[model samples]
Target: MGKKLLNKPLSTRVISLNNSQIKGIKHKKKKSKKGGPIPVKELVPKSSALFFQYNTQLGPPYHILMDTNFINISLKNKLDIFKGLMDCLYAKVNCYITECVMGEIEKLGNKFRIALRIAKDPRFERITCLHKGIYADDCLVNRVQQHKCYIIATCDKDLKRRIRKIAGVPIIGVANHRFTVEGMPDAFGAPKM
Candidate 1:
């Protein structure tokens, strides 16, 4: 059993039919091949109290999944990621970092050592990824496929363009010394039918 929220008494976790938890997934590209949903006991890990705090109907306070470019570009523009995010969107942000993005920062050598420092901030939650050795861009792209409302923060031009292909995805980036958001993601985390 996991800990319950502070305001509410302990209650059974509600199960929603439309949630993105893939029970049996088999990932395959070719017609002859088949794929099944990887068994996931809980899509939102118990440790993530912030993610559990969000409700879709209120419409705001996005959960952000950051890219390495988000760090580099923000620092390059002399902005704190959180501070910049605060300047960009009206809603509060719950920030997260994937393992791959941290890995990328580490691999950048001394020139980018400052980024490694930024990644150490306790404010950002960790989004565990099953696949390793892939770039942060690929992992972030895969995340949007889950139909979750995650505002992606990055300054990579190409990556921004790539993300636009996915519907209902909001993006944040730095422009002229301030953070700017292109659109706001739907907090309900519903994929387009």
Candidate 2:
């Protein structure tokens, strides 16, 4: 077995050191060349152009598409998912729900009764996914492929991996108390916040 730090024998020199000498200490300053604090945009080159500033005068370029798990998470947490998305995206985002997701939510039965109720929100545009299957993840991927401007809100790890494979697509995940963007497209349109 390796020698433990606490069991290690002290050197005679260290033992011989006087209390006065041991007490004195110096604070070393960093010598590396450091740049001054720059603006948020300057620090991240092309970030401003990539994540768009929310402008009410101009229409938003992106829309939010919700997944089953994402909706359930909102219902579970008692959060206004749409309001959170708008706040994070810094623009009013048109929300959409896929037929496949609805099927998945409905299948959860009474356990997800609240989520099912929330899913009936009229504000969310019901999208008929081209891939008519029971797999909600596959349907979401297909719909997103069709709508390049869509920013999908989901908590599924596997779904996130699939989304990253497609370039210029953004995925939103809830972290702590706020929503986070996983991918920033070249066109940019998230918020500085």
Candidate 3:
């Protein structure tokens, strides 16, 4: 008998529910509106300079913040930074490199000497980084967040994604051996992702 009982499946057992067990269990009911229309009060402060998601601060003599990899990618593609920017934007462009980016280039060492030489060029204005750490990506993102006037130049996908979240900032990168910009309405040459 014990052997036969052990051989039987557990699912074959019959179970019954008591009246209290059925009544004690509560069923979830759909929420019903009890009152009239409710007004939602939300306040979001927007900058006065921003007009319809377009930054009025951006114009001719564009200021561009250069990333560490952007320099290497430009060199690899045989693209001249100054000429490429001018050709793409059709305006005077000033390239700014942060101290963290400079440090990152230096840390890359010997093989990137050519890239290092290009980054140190006098034409590329150097911006002092007050924050700690030598992480270039965070430095670039933070700087762009504080100032919407700059156009970020980067080949890194992660950095581009972060910049895309911020409003009114444009991004420029090398594509088809030429520079392409995005996030600006007037930029016709900017390639769509």
CA RMSD of each candidate after superposition: 16.9, 18.5, 16.6
lDDT tens readout by residue for model 1, 1-193: 3445454554635545555774465556443225654544655432221243342322456688899988888887888777667656665878999999988888898999888888988998988889968598989988875645687888898899988866556777777787776654432222224
State the TM-score for model 3.
Answer: 0.75
- How many clashing residue pairs appear in each of the predictions shown? 8, 4, 0
Error of 1 at 7 (Å): 69
Quote the lDDT for 180 in model 3. 90
Residues 33-92 of candidate 3 have per-residue lDDT tens digits of 865455566965666667888989999899999998899999999999999899889899
TM-score of every model versus the real structure? 0.64, 0.63, 0.75
lDDT of 2 by residue, 1-193 (tens): 2455446666523433456765576656544356544334443232222334322222374578889988877666677887777767676788888888899989989999888888888988898766646788887787766546677899999999998766556788776656777564222333344
Report how far residue 87 has shifted in candidate 3, in Å: 0.6
Whole-model lDDT values for every prediction: 0.72, 0.71, 0.88
Clashing pairs in 2: 50-188, 50-189, 51-189, 52-189
TM-score: which candidate is best? Answer: 3
